[model samples]
Target: MSDRICCPLCRCAEVLLSKAYPEQAEVLALLREHGPMTASEIRAKVDKSIGVTAINNRLERLRAFELVARTRYGNGWKYIAKPEVES
Candidate 1:
């Protein structure tokens, strides 16, 4: 397989895949399914095989990319998927 990574926004193959941050895709997929969730909720939805820290890191990256939005809910924050608009 090629090392090229597709941009989740434009779906273009311009994004250089990062091995250091490999869990991004999986996290995005999960968000697409069960987003608008808190970090703990996300941890619960994810496979028990993965580490909690890894999921948190992936969430941080996703938030930075604006693929997900973090909202303040009570004392904690909730993550929600930023829907892509079809033109």
Candidate 2:
């Protein structure tokens, strides 16, 4: 059986995003609240338990989900949360 929960009234994408990993949600919130930020910057602001590599992983996953986007920034990359989709 699938591990994800489904709601008949919700959009598929919205349901998937709602079920995203906690770390991914954190990363998204940081970008939305603080504007674009590098992985290193996110690492510094995220929970101490979340490491640099984990931060990078979450960023990439969020990107794949189209919930976030990245751009070249200095020598590294900066990520920002995509604008929320209207219901």
Candidate 3:
């Protein structure tokens, strides 16, 4: 089929390292600490210094790379670390 592969953690790292996005780094660290979390939850845990749109953008990138999975949690989205990458 195709030769392209997706990786969220790598994408996250690339983006973060490319521009030194502090928010991205903070989010990654939070994810590592708390395991999995929704965008709103992460924002809250991170002190809401960054806006929702930025958080959403980062989450989208993470999801695309398959680094995280998004699921419906009641009325909002819940993000969890992909089990395959836990190691």
TM-score of each: 0.65, 0.74, 0.61
Candidate 1 residue pairs in backbone clash: none
How would you encode candidate 3's per-residue C-alpha lDDT over 1-87 as one tens digit per residue?
111214766555546544665555566556656877888889887666787778889888767766567888888788775654321
- Candidate 1, 1-87: lDDT as tens digits: 123223454554113323444467666666667657777777787788877777778888888877778889998778776766554
Ranking by lDDT: 2, 3, 1
RMSD of each: 5.1, 6.0, 7.6
lDDT by residue (1-87, candidate 2, tens digit) is 112224543345544565767667667777878889999999999788878898999999999889789999988899987776544
Error of 1 at 41 (Å): 1.3
Preferred candidate (TM-score higher): 1 or 2:
2
lDDT of 1 at 75: 89
On the 0 to 100 scale, the lDDT of residue 19 in model 3 is: 68
The local distance difference test score of each candidate is: 0.66, 0.76, 0.66
Best by the TM-score measure: 2
Sorted by TM-score, highest first, which candidate order results?
2, 1, 3
